[model samples]
Structures are given as structure tokens and as C-alpha cells.
Target chain A: MARLFKPRMLALAVLAALASRAHAEPAAAPARAEVLHWWTSGGESAAARTLADAFRAAGGTWIDTAVAGSEQARAVAVSRVAGGNPPTAALFNASRQFRDLVDQGQLTALDDVARQGGWDRVMPPAILDAVRVNGHVYAAPVDIHMTAWIWYSKAAFKKAGIAAEPRSVEELFQALDRLRAAGLIPLAHGGQPWQDSIVFRAVLASVGGRDLYLRVFRDRDPRAIESPEFRQVLLTFRRLHGYVDAGSPGRHWNDATGLLVAGRAGVQIMGDWVRAEFSAARQRAGVDYGCLPGLGEHAPYVIQADAFVFPKNRDAATARTQALLATTVTSPAVQVSFSSRKGSLPVRSDVELPSPDPCVALAAALMRDRARQLPNDEMFLTPDQAGAMADVLTAYWNRDMPVETVQKKVVAALRDDL
Target chain B: MRATWAARAALVPVALTALLGYLGSTLWTAQMSVTASRTLPSDHFVGMAQYVRLFSNERWLLSLDNLLLYGVLFISACLLAGSVLAILVDREIAARGWLRQIFLYPYAMSFIATGAVWQWILNPTDGIQAVGRALGFSAFRFDWIVDPDRVLLTIVIATAWQASGFVMAILLAGLSGVDPDLWRAARIDGIPTWRVYTSIVLPQLGYAFATALVLLLTGVVKLYDAVVAMTQGGPGTASEVPTKFIMDHLYGRANLGLASAGAIVLLVTVLALLAPFLYARTRAAASIA
Candidate 1:
């Protein structure tokens, strides 16, 4: 009996040893993390590579899964999570995009990492608010992007005989006329829904002024959407459509930038990401191209941030890797380096920016003014409402729909469950 | 006794697959459609509100309308084009084998790349319009892709180009299966060529035509990639279809309840149209047997 018991005890001992070894952290294994993002564009790719390099330097593995468009990438990530296999981290625009993820308990709360890194003191309130969910940090914001920038080719402006940037809506229209007469596309436009919405928001901020813009988009007030002020903004947005080339429909943002690069188009109202396109074409900022945040000095600068969210998982190794990724993404060096290349500003206002391209530096400076900073519509409205608004805006731009009809439609859409 | 258990064992995989994958998912989706699900399926039931919203949505209504148009046009065109191609190939046409290969080649390429290529060819700037202007025919305008009123027509043309080959292949198989004796008998009867084709050949090819129609119908319902790649349902949602609308709500807008309701509506619509046709076919087969 004693001999039989001895053999059984030996078998149990061996099984315990194997179990401990399976779980015991291998002191030498690198923390491998796979990141999914839409930074596959040439410049965005390089910016992502900067983060990869920093992560590598800190002794971690970086796996990239880049999808071209942000919406496409996010969709793939969400599907992956639903399929029970999610990436270590995924890139998301700083908005209400991850609200569903948090609500479903799919995101790992990054509050511990946020506290450890002193994120509250570094990041601006707006940016922090964008990444926070229910008093917990659910994402690590990487860069801040100003979406309402007017980009123009300096050479085209010179040929058009416009000496300086237009300070008013009327002057801007006159400049467009001069550009048109000079045999260039008055506005380099991509007639995609998002692109049309970006122009509409810029017009909203510049013409409708910030309060009305906020009331309609942020507050989603039906009265504000129905007001004459919103109608005027819509009309101005529609008027700009006339300046666009016939080929604007289905054109890519890069193609629009290409028109500016080749001096075929005079101006483009686009996000600061256009700066990367100019840089890629070997055009110098302030020399070959120029930027205007808005027509007026007090025009609110619309801000959108790109963030990384870690998926919740039970695996200890995966959780540890996620925590590490959250820390690395918000590291000051990574933030500065990524923003410098990405044509966006750093999320943390306290971080000293590296010498960015001239356009990025200007955007960074503009971000410094508190009054100029305004969260993008996604930051306020739910993704559903934002998509509905985009549909309305694009439809109005494409068709000769009456302004009153558009106003009524806008009000009706906003009046749906907020 | 041995055969009974073995047969029952063989049935297990199909049972498991249908129960877990198909029926399970359908039930889950139907449940979620009742709730105000966003991003993920939620248990918060909101009754028939999502269906109400789906019916009220302008884009959704337009998508349904476009799907109907696209369905009728795409299927009929594919059938006609495929039959014509098959008939020509079966005749004493020169280089018949090479022609068959050429017609079938487009199916090998991804629709994403094909759609982009088609977009360029249809664009007003550098496409048919530019070529027309270059040839001194300035009045010629083939920019149906950009014109909102005619964008869906361009999609139809591009989709037909990709799909007609598949239809042709199916019809060609049916054509080959035709007994040579029938043609010889028709020749001896002094029947006209068109009469032989219309009365004899076409009636025999009914099964092939039915198969093509059903396949094309499925393709029409699942038509999302081409629309996304070509126009992205744009020109102010003029070309939006039900599948793309459901997809937009599914992930982009994070409104799964609305998306599910839309899917259920689409499924029910397809079932309503297809059920009687399928039942009639089955009944005819049983009666013939």
C-alpha cells in the first residue's frame, strides 16, 4: 500500500511542476503586442513606425495590422472582438466610437496606467474627456488633429493675385473667383460624405460662428438646427460646392492634394493631414503651400484625436501586454515623435513638441489657444447621430435641395432619440 | 442495425452546424432587433421602435428601392447576355475556345480593383467623356457614374460586366447537354433557326436559366462590395442598397438593433419573393417523377 501511494504522490508532484512552469513568467520573453490601426497611408505609416520603434527600444514586439480607412479598421477590430479573438490594441479616433466597447465591457480600463503616468496633469481636459469612460480611462490618446484647415498652394495663390489669406467669407469667395479665372480648380474637393461634412463644419464655425455650430452639433438642439443661422451656413457650404471641379465626385483626399501639388487647384479645405501630402511632394510649408485655420481670427479650431484602446481579456499575459501598450502609447517621447510625423499635435499639452514640419508647428500653436479649441462633432454626438448628420450634409451638398427643406430635415434628424 | 447507427452518426455534423451556426445566429439577430442594441447586442428591449426607424429612414427607403431596381435589371440583363454569348459560342464562330476564355477572365479578378478601374473609365475627367472630347465629339457625355440620377446605371453596367460571364458558363453547360439528334431532327423538319432556338432549345434550357436567376438573385441581395468599391453608395446616397445600409448601421453607426431589423426585413422580403417560386419548382419535380 505504501509503495503504491508513493508512485501516485510522485505523479502528482510532476503535474504540479508542469503547471507552475507553464504559468511562470519567462524572464527573457519579450512582451509581444499586436496593434491594429488605419495608419497605412504613406505618412501615417511612417508615424506608426515611430511608435513601433519606440516600443521596440523598450524591449517589446510590435505587430502591425493596418487597414486603409479609419472606419474600415475600426469595423474589422470590432468584428474581431466579437469573434472572440481581438488584437492587443486598436487605433480609434478620439470620439464616442468606443462608447459601445466600454458599455459591453470589452475594453480594459486603463485607469491604473493613467494614474501611474500622470496623464491627468499632462493631457488637456478635452482630450482626457474624450478618452475617459464612466470616470475610468479606457483609451490612450496618441495625437490631436485639427480638422478645419484651409490649405492652398502658394504658387496658385500668387498666380491668382491674392496677396494674403482671406480674412472674411466674402474675400475668400473673391479669391476663389480669381483662382477660377486663372484656370485652376477653385476648390480641390473630394465629394465623399466625410469630406463634405468637414467642409460643412468649417463653414459652420466660420460663418455660423462657434455658438450656433456647437448648439446644432454638440447640443443637437432642434431649434438651433432650424434657425436661419444654420440655414446660412448650409447655403455657404452649398455655394462652395459650385467652386469644386466636376471630377470632385468620388475623388480621394490625396487626389485633391495632387491637384494642389500640380498647381491645378488653388485651395483645399481639408484637415491638417494634407500637410503630409505637401511634404511628400517635396513642397515646403509657408513656401509652396499655406494654411488657414479659418477665415476669422476667433474661429474655433475643431479638434479630433486618434487614440488606442486595449481589449479586455482574461489571459494574464495579454492583460500585462495591454497595460504596457497603454503606457507606451502615452509616453511623452512617443507622443511627440508620432505627432511630429503624423501632421497632428501632441495630446498632452505639457509635452515639449519636437521640431515638427512648419504646418504641424502652426497647428500645435493654434491648439494652444483655449478659445480656439473645439471638440469634433463625434466627441459630442453619438456615432449614429453623427452618421445621420453626415448623410444630410452630403445630400444637401450634392443636390439643389431648398435650404428650408434641408433645415427641416436637419431638425427632424436631430430630433430623433438623442 | 449496423446501418441505422452509422446513418444517424453521419447526420450529426449537419445537425450541429445548422443548429449552432445558422439557426443560432438567426435567432440571436432576431432577438437583438427588438432591443436598442448599439455596437454590441444588448438586452434592453425597445419593442418595434427600430423597425419604425428603419421604415422612416430616407436612406433605408432609397436603398430598398435601388435594390429592387438593381435586382430586376441585373438578373434579366445577365440572363439575356449570358444566353446570347452561349448561343454564339455554340455556333460555328471563329476562335470559339479563346472567346470563351476571354469572356470568363473578369471573374478571376477582385471586384475592388475592378471597381476602381471601372470608375476611371466612367469618370467625366479622364474617362469616356475625355476620350470623346479628344476625338472632337465634345457633346458626348458618358459620365453616368457622377450624375446622381444615373449613378446606379453605371453600377449596373460594371456589375453586369463581372457577372455575365458566370451566367454564360452555366448556360453553356446546359447548351452542351442538348442532344445532337434534336438539332438534326429540327433541321430535317425544315424549321427556321430562330424557331428551333426559341421553341426547342430554350424550353430545354429552363433548368439552367432558373439556376442562373437564383444565383443572380443571391448576388444582388449580397451586393455590398461593388457598391462600396465603386461609388461608396454616394452622390448623396442615390446608389445606396439595403445591404450597405444594414452594414453602415451594423458597425459604422454602432446601431445593431436597427441593422438587425433591416436585415430581418430584407430576409423576409427575399423569402416572400422566393418561397412560391421554390415551392412550385419542387412540386413540378415531384409531379414529373
Candidate 2:
């Protein structure tokens, strides 16, 4: 009982200290920051270390709190903020994910840091717009992750007798068919709902093209969803279902990546972060494996970013640390190093690639073209709408649901946005 | 077992905990179900909209069906296997103590570790089927782990493997208390052993079976960990249960309104199913008294 009571007393003491700090007098305290994020993977951990190291160099003490999954991490962060023990910084995707939190005045905007770093000019429009909610920067953008990259095993491609990267959707399917004929698993896919949504979005961008894809996702246009083009995309997505093995269902994305890693499967449509897996397996990009960002020239570069948001904290010392940490993380030195390890492009366009991987270099070049910049579904859809849309895609993937029904459901899912 | 002042005082903490933790949250959930809450609770009430949306959802519907299939199959299989194991040990079988310990061993382990191991063993491509082929039994197949139509049964198998031993332990205690004279009289009458056990011993084990049944039922309703560890309610929502659906909405989708609504519906269902059983139990007790 004494042992138990001791921990409870200590917890209460900490809570009391935090409570008093919420109304603490302005004092010149040492810079200390508590950062909460969902970046527990090996590559992500190293990326976090870069930021931590940078903050330490910038005269701040960095405290790291990493949760394994985004949903759980965000929940913990939000609860902490609500419970009056908000961390100095919490990581959120550069999307409408934090819109309500900002509305409730729970976030500290980093407009000063944004101006100091010239974020307006360097950041891509999609990411810039995401962080700059209501003309104030609510998050410090770290890295840009492209969502529509098609990764392939070079060995599998060789066995399939493929000569070069397919430049068009038709050619891409032809390559998949060749891989299928070679008696290898053509598409190594995890059948989780999110994974299903990834495949669907990849198909939407590659097969449906830029305008159709943007209209359905960004505009939530009902007519666009009902269009023949969207129908074709849906059909194409359903057709790829036949390419995966029986073990694809309920499999993790990393396990699916392992199929490519082992040369047992040909291709996987996933984010740029797959580079970490290749790196771990000692498979050099453009040699052991290859990446195609999209179908062709007409395809837009789909951008998803991870950013840090400061929780509402009035303590002078904590606010100072938050500012220091935000500025340090977005600085070119930190962004370049962090993004490289994180398998994402630096948020800053100014940073020159140092030891750039092949796929990342291609994505960076594509990201430079303003017209080709498109945000992922999360940026456009509320988390609710995105989840509903995922359900529609997953249902279609797992069942013999007709393409027409899927089209109607997709429109209904975006009805709130409409 | 007398209710004393110290015992009554002791009940204070448990009572307070139950009132605040269970009843308080349940009321809050009921209130939230009527609101248009996104990530957090809000006061703006939109009555029944969430409930309506929940029913309209294909994923929710599929989860309910999976839960029903899983519940019926999991409980029955556990009861059957548990009873069989108990009876086998009861007959003074060879290495009875060792066999009893082996049967109860799975109960001591956690579902998380067990489920993950089961996932690997049941994985079709490189797990059981691959092993079978390697051992020259290429015709052997157990791809139900990935099959959409049959995935819930795989959940049943994995959960039963963990839960059956628990049931066996309960039944064994009930078997021990059975009258020795009933067995001796049955032996004199030349009744078959299976008939004697079923007609005599099984009827007397009703109280024990009820206790086991109630526990197993609760397990079925709160079935989250096994599904999460084993299948994550996927292969595209094929194995999603109501708890997973509610959790996904409550956190992942940030639709607490829908999640609360789901909770309400699930609660009503459990009550509806339990009311008759509870009423019948009271009636039986009243008649005896």
C-alpha cells in the first residue's frame, strides 16, 4: 500500500506543479520542450533524433513522447491538452485534422517563426495552405510525403522481362500483367482499410488523371464521382484485387513491403516511406528496386505532410521553448537531415538534396512544379469523411460490390463536404 | 459471509468507482449519442442522426453479423471442448494430473501473445499450408484465416483455444462435487457410462455451467484484443466486431457521436438477450425458496 501510495503522491505532485505553471509568474527558466508524436518506426525514430539533436544545439532540452500509431497518439495529445497537461509540441498531419483544435484556441500559432523562416515562399501551396489556417501558421511543417508512389522489386521486374519503367497507366497494367505471367504475386497489398484506400487513391491519381482526381476528392463533386472516368478508376481498382495473394488480407503494410523485399512479389503501391524498408533490407533504390511517382506527366504529385503543432501554453518558459523548437525543426539543416531519414522530402524547397535517394529525388523534382501539386484525401476530407470513404473502398475491395454502387457510396460519403 | 460495518465501509470505494466509472460514463455516452460531436463532446444535440447513420453504414452492419457469428460459435465450441476435456480427466485417465495441467495452461497465457502466434500459424501462404507442403502433404490447406466468408470462425478457433481451458476448470470443480452413490447405482444398473454421465452428472452441473456461460458471454461482447491482435477486424471489415467499430469511430474517425450511438445499441442488445435469462433464473430460485 505504501508503494502504491508513493506513486500516486508523486503523480499528484507532478499534476500540481503543472497546474501551478498554467498560471505561473513570468520567469526566465531554461528552455525545455515536451514533444508528443507518433513516429516509433526505426526510420521515424532516427528522424526524431535529428530534431532532438537540433533542439539541443539550439539551447533547449527536448523531451520525446512517441506513440506507435497516429490515431492513438492524437487521442493522447488531445486528452492531455484537455486535461491541462498539454505537451509543448504535438505532431499532427498538415490537414484539416487540427482545425477544431485551432478553432477552440488550443494551438499556438507560429506566425513569427513562419515569417522569420520565409515559409510562404519555400513551402508548397498544399502544405502552406494546410498549416496557415485562417492566415496564421498553426503548425511547423517538417516533411512532405508523397502518397502515390508505386514501388517494385527490380529482381521481380527482371524475371517478368520488363525493359523499362511504364510511363502510362496502360503500360503500368501491362507490366503488372507481365509480372502476373511470371508466376509472382503481381501486387503485394495489405488488405487493411487504410491500405485499401491507398490503393484506391493511387488508382484514382494514375488512372483517373489530375482533374478528375482533384474534382472528386478536393471539390467532392457528385457529378465527378458519377462520371465515366471515376467509374473506370473504380473498375481498375477492383481488377487489381485479383493480383494479390490469399495472405494479403489482414496483413500489415510492412509485411506486404516484405514481399517486395524478398523478391516474391513484383509491385506495391504505397507512400515514399517504403524507402526505409528497402534501406533496412540493404536494397538500393534504382538498383534492387524502383519507384514510379505517378502514371505519367499528366499525373499530379500527391502530397501528405507531417507537421508539429504547439499546444496552448501560457507559461513563459514553455512558450519560449516551443518557439525555439519550432524554428529549429523547420530550419534547412534540420529539415534536410530529418526528411532524409524520415523518407520524405524536406518541406523547404530551398534545401539542396544531400545524398538523395532515387525515388525521393524524382518526387522532389515533381513537387517543384506548382500545377502538379495536389494534397492527399486527408487534406480535403475531414477525418470522418476520409474514414467513410475508406469504408466504401474497403467494401468494394473485399466483396463483389458493383462499381456503380461504389460510385454512389463515394458521393454519399462526401455529402457532408458537398 | 455476514455483511459487517467494515465490509459496508469497504464497499464505499467499489460503490463510488462503479457509480462514477460505469454509470457516469454510460450516461455521458447516452448524452453524446444525441449530439453532433466530432473529436470531442459538444452540447448541440442532433437526436438519432448518429444512430441512423450507424445503421446505414455497411461496415457497422457487417460487424454486427460477424459478432453474432463469432459469439454463437465461440461460446458453443468453448463449452463443448471444455466439457469433453473435463470428462476425459474425470475418468482417471493416464497422466491425469499432467493432462489437466496441459488443458489449463492456455488459460494462464494472454490473448495478445497467443493471437499473434496463432496469426503466424494460420497464415495461409507461408504458415500451415507451406509447412504442410514442405512435409509432402501439398493437399493440406487452412487458408480460412484470410478468407472473408470464413475469417470469423478462425477468430472462434483462436479464442476458444484460450477460453476452453477456463471452462474445463469450472466444470471439473462441478464434477468433483457430484454424489458418489449416483455413479455406484448406475454401475449396478448396468447403464452405459456416457448415458449415466449425461443424464445424471450433466444435469447437476447446471449452476457451474451458468457461471461459465455468463463469463463467456461477457467475453464475447467485449471481444476486442483477439480481433485486434489476430486480424485487426480486416481483410476489409470481414472480422470487425461492434467493439472495434465503436472504438474506430470513437478515436480513429473522431466521430464520438456515432461511437456512443453504437455503444447504446450494443448495450440494449446485451440487455435484451440477458433479461429473459435473468428473469427465468430468478423464477427458478423463487420456486425453490
Candidate 3:
């Protein structure tokens, strides 16, 4: 009885101490903000630290919660928000990902912050449209990522006797053939579903043209899916699968990029994130490697962005902290620093990169031409629809399905009723 | 004797936790399955729609097929390999402890680590296939990890390697309990050692085999981590399992209603498979009493 009594008394004493310490904290404790993001990789975390530093300089406390994978991070953020203890801010792709949160009144609108920052003038129209839902802004745009870049190893190209960059789909195939003849892996592809869909998007943008791409993805027109042009795009996408090595299945995106960095593979159709890998290997863009936004001169530029949304919080101090974070991340100086380190284009067009990278410069040049600017499918499709479409595309990519059957599957997958 | 009131009072918290935590959440999930829940659960009733969509989903159907194939192969391989290992270890070997540790080491590692190691070993470009080619065997090929039809088999091989060790330990424990007098009697009767093992010793290990089967079956149903660490339901969804499907919908796709329906289906499957075994066990116990 004495032993039990002593431990219980000690536990009560500890609890009393903890409660007193909690009560003793100053009422004006620096407006604390916990930012949830999926940026734990070396370069990505460095980029995220810039935002944390800026927030600290702005007289607010910055708590960083970095989850390793985007899907997992968003899952945690969503569940936390549902569980009623959401972070001060959580990262999301600037797309329909957070549309449900807005519809459910779970996100705090950022109209005041948007107006103060002149977001209407600074942000590109595509990104601005993504953040503004029902005449109120719900997300703060951070960086722009173009998804359909063709990254190739110059060493592999030269060894395969390719003289210049392929400017058309026909020329790209010829280059792939030359690389294969040289006994090299022609395509450095990771066989994950998302990576497979990236290749499909590149093919759709280059082969199907902007109109067909929009019709198939944005409009979800069944006619567009079954058309001969779309079939040709599917055929081209599958044709490139022949160039991949036997070890392509389940290979990670970075490992695939490593192939190009090592000059073992000729080309990889991925997003601008691959630049981080090349740079990590000390390969300079336009020197050791080259990036083409797409195969054709006027191919559609499929763009996506990483942004932050403030989960609805009733606390006045937290609201102020959230607004401060929004303004700090979107400022011109912060945008430039974050984008340069993160291998993405700055969300604000007004910012100037201190030292421009060749690939980013190319993307910036393409961004100015509003005629070629297109939103990636994620911006238009709900998360569920996007996943379903990915399933069809990946199945088609890995299997020997007929083009007509694939078209049927795509139409079914994109049906809004489901 | 009746349990004391103090003991019953002491069990209140645990009893309440079981009733509310497990049973209550299970009921909530069933209710959610019948609603039009997406990113968050809503009260809007949409009966049978999510289940309809789940059944029609090609990925879900393929996942079920893969789970079936994986279940049969993984369980049989683990049982056979475990029995052989237990028999081998039961002999009076000089390095019994070392052999036991060596066989059981993989069970100590997480499925993720085991999956990663096996993935590297089975990769065609730089794994065993490359070594075979390097040794002047130009025609050698073992690229099943990337083949759409054969990727599920690779998962079976990986998970079986991780779980068979555990099954071996169970069987070895059961083997140790076998009567030494029966062995002496068999020796006096001049019965062969292999015959004694097959005809007499194995029959006595029924409870151990049942326990191992239950563990292996649950492992088969929850076969997500190894698949994720290795194939991630790819070479185009060929290695997908039911748990992976439910998880993808639950979080990544934000279709909670469909995910809940999948969970209920998996629960029903497990209950159906375990019912007869549990009933038989109860009957056997009652007869012994």
C-alpha cells in the first residue's frame, strides 16, 4: 500500500508541475505556427527552411513538420484537420485537392492576404485561378512546376551520334533508336503509376496537341478519347515503353534520373524535379544534360504548383500567424530564393532569379506565352477521378491492351457519376 | 468460484475500451460505408453505391485476384518450408543454436527491410541475372519482378522468406513437446525415422500447425507493406492486394465510403475463413473436458 501510494502521489505532483508550467507561459507568446509540408529531401528541406527563416524574421514562431512523401503528408494533414487539431498551415498541390476542404468550410479564406500582396497582379493566371475558389482565395501559391519536361543526357546523346536536340516527335523517336543501337537504355523510366502517367502526359501534350490534350483531360470528352489522334498518342506512349530496360519496374524516380546522370540512359520524361538529381550529381544543365519542355516547338506547357492552405482556425492569434506566413512565402524575394533552391519556377512572375538556371529560364520563357500555358489534369480533375485515370493509363502502359480498350477505360474512369 | 466484485470492478475500463474502441469504431465504419463520404464523413445516405463502384473497379478486382493467388502460394510455401526446417533443426546437430538463429533472423526484421533486400536481389539489371550473365551464361534470365503476369509471384517469394522463419519456430516448439518414449518405442519396433515423423510426429503438432495457419492467413490478408516496399502495386497494378486498395482509396484518393466497403468485405472474408477452425477447436476442447 505504501509503494502504490508513493507512486500515485509522485504522479500527481508531476501532473501539477506540468499544469503550472502550462499556466505560467506568457500570454503574448510569439504567434506560433506549425507548417506541415512534404519536403524532407536535402534540396527540398533547404528550400523549405528559407520560408521558415522568413517567418521567424517576420516575428512569428515557425514549427516545421516535414513528412517524406506527398501522398502521406496530405493524408496526415487531411486526417488532422478532420480530427480537429489541424496544423497552422499544410502544403497541398495547387489543384482540386483542397476543393473538398473549401466546400466543407474547413479552410480559411485568404482574401485579405491576397489583396495585400497584390496577388492578382503578381501570380500567373493559371495559378491564381487554382487558388481562388468561389471569389475567395483558399491557398497561397508558392512555386510552379512544369510536369512534361524531356530531360536527356548529353553524354549519352553524343555517344549515340545524335547531333542536336529532337525538335519533333519523329526526331525524338529517331534519337531513341540511335541510343538503343548504341546498346544504351533509351528511356530512363520508373514504372510507378504516377511516373507512367507523366510519360503519358508528355506524349499527350506533344503528339495529341494542346486541343486534344485539353479535350481528353480537362473536358473529359468521350469523342476526344476515341479519336484517331488520341489513339496515335497512346501508340506513341506505348512505343517508348519498348526502350526501357527490364529493371524499369518499381524503380524510383530518382534512380531513373541517376541513369541519365551516369550517362547510362539517353532520356527521361519527368518533371523539373529531376534537375535536383542532376545538380546533385554535379551535372550542369545545357552542359552535362539538357531539358526540353516538350518535343514540339509549340507543345502545351502542362503546369502544376505546390501551395499552402490554412485549415480553418478560430484563434485570432493563429489567424494572424497564418496571414503572415501567406504573405511571407509569396513575397518576391522569398519566391526567388525558394524556387531557385527547389528547382521550380517562382509562382510570382514579377520576381527575378539572382542567377538564372538554363532550364528554369526556358520554363519562364514558356510561361510568358499564355497561349501555350495549360493546367495539368490534377487541377481540373478531383483526386478520385485523377487516381482512376492514373490506373487506366498505368495499366495500358504496362500491359498489351488495345488502344480502343484503353480509350473505353479512360472514358469510364473519367465519368463524373462514379 | 465466482469472480470477486473487486476484479469485475477493475475490469470495467478494459471492458469499456473493448466495447467502445473496437466494436464502436467497427459500427461507425459500417455506417460510413453506406454514406456518400469523401474526404470527410457526411450523414448523406447512399446505400450500396460505394460497394457497386468498388466491385466494378478494375484495380480492385485485380487486387482481389492477386490476393487470392498470393494467399495460396505464400501459405503453402511457408508451411512446407517451416516443417522441413523444424525437422532438420530437431536433429542433434553440433551448431543447433547457430542454425536456429540463422533461420530466425529474417523474422526479426520488418517486412519493409526484407522486401527491399529481395527487390535488389531480384532486379534484372544488376542482381542475380547480371551476375549470371557476367559469368558467361549469356542466355540466363530471371526478370520475373518486372513481368506483369509474374510480379505477384515475386511478392510471394519475398513474404514467404520473411514469415517461414516464424512458422519454423512454432513448429520447433511443438516438436520439442513430442514424447521421447514414442521415439524409443518406434526405434524398438524398427520403424523408419522419416515414417515416424510423417505418420506419428506431424499428427501430434495439429495445434501448432493451426496456430501457424491463422498467423499466416492474417499475414496474407494484411499483405501491404512488403508489396509497397517492393512493387508498390505495379508493373501496372499486378501485385496489388486488398489492403493496398483499401489504403489507396482511404487516404490518397479520399474516397472513404468505398474504402470502408472494402474493409467490411475483407473483415467478412477473415471471419468466414476462421469460423470453422474455431468451432472445431471448441468442439475438441469440450470433448476432452
Best by lDDT: 3
Docking tier of model 3: it is medium
TM-score of each model, paired residue for residue? 0.91, 0.94, 0.94
Q: Give the alpha carbon lDDT tens digit for every residue of A1-418 in model 3.
A: 0000011121233343344333333225547887878787778889999999988988887777765567767777787788677788999999988888999999989999999999998778888888889999999999998998999999999999999999999999999999999999999998888889999998998888889988998899999999999999999999999999899988888899999999999999999888888888999988999999987778887898999999987667778888999999999889988988898888987877877778878888888887898888888888889999999988888999889999899998998843
Off by over 4 Å in 1: A1-32, A59-68, A80-86, A112-118, A315-324, A415-418, B1-11, B177-182, B185-191
Worst 10 residues of 1 chain A by lDDT: A1-10
Task: Residues B1-289, candidate 3: write the lDDT tens digits.
Answer: 2568889989999999999998998899999899888888887899999899989999999989988999999999999999999898888477777878988998899766677788899999989999999999999999999999998888888888888888999999999999999999999999999999999999999999999999999999988888877888889878888888888888778888989999999989999999999999999999999
Residue-level lDDT tens digits of model 2 in A1-418 = 0000011122333454454345333335568787878788777888899999999998887777765567667776776776777878888899888877887888988999999999988999889888887899999989988877899999999999999988887887898999999999999998888888888888888888789978998899999999999999999999989889988887777888899999999999988777888889999999999998888876776888898999877686777788898899999988888887888888999998796877777887887898887788888888889988988888789888878888999998887821
Candidate that beats the other on TM-score, 1 or 2, i.e. the better one: 2
Q: After superposition, how far is residue B200 of candidate 3 from its true place, in Å?
A: 1.8
Worst 10 residues of 2 chain B by lDDT: B247-256
Off by over 4 Å in 3: A1-30, B1-3
Clashing residue pairs, backbone N/CA/C < 3 A, model 1: none
DockQ of every candidate: 0.46, 0.43, 0.52
Off by over 4 Å in 2: A1-30, B1-4
Give me candidate 3's TM-score against the actual structure: 0.94
Q: With candidate 1 superimposed using the best TM-score fit, by how many Å does residue A146's alpha carbon deviate from the native? A: 0.6
Q: What is the DockQ score of candidate 3, to 2 decimals? A: 0.52
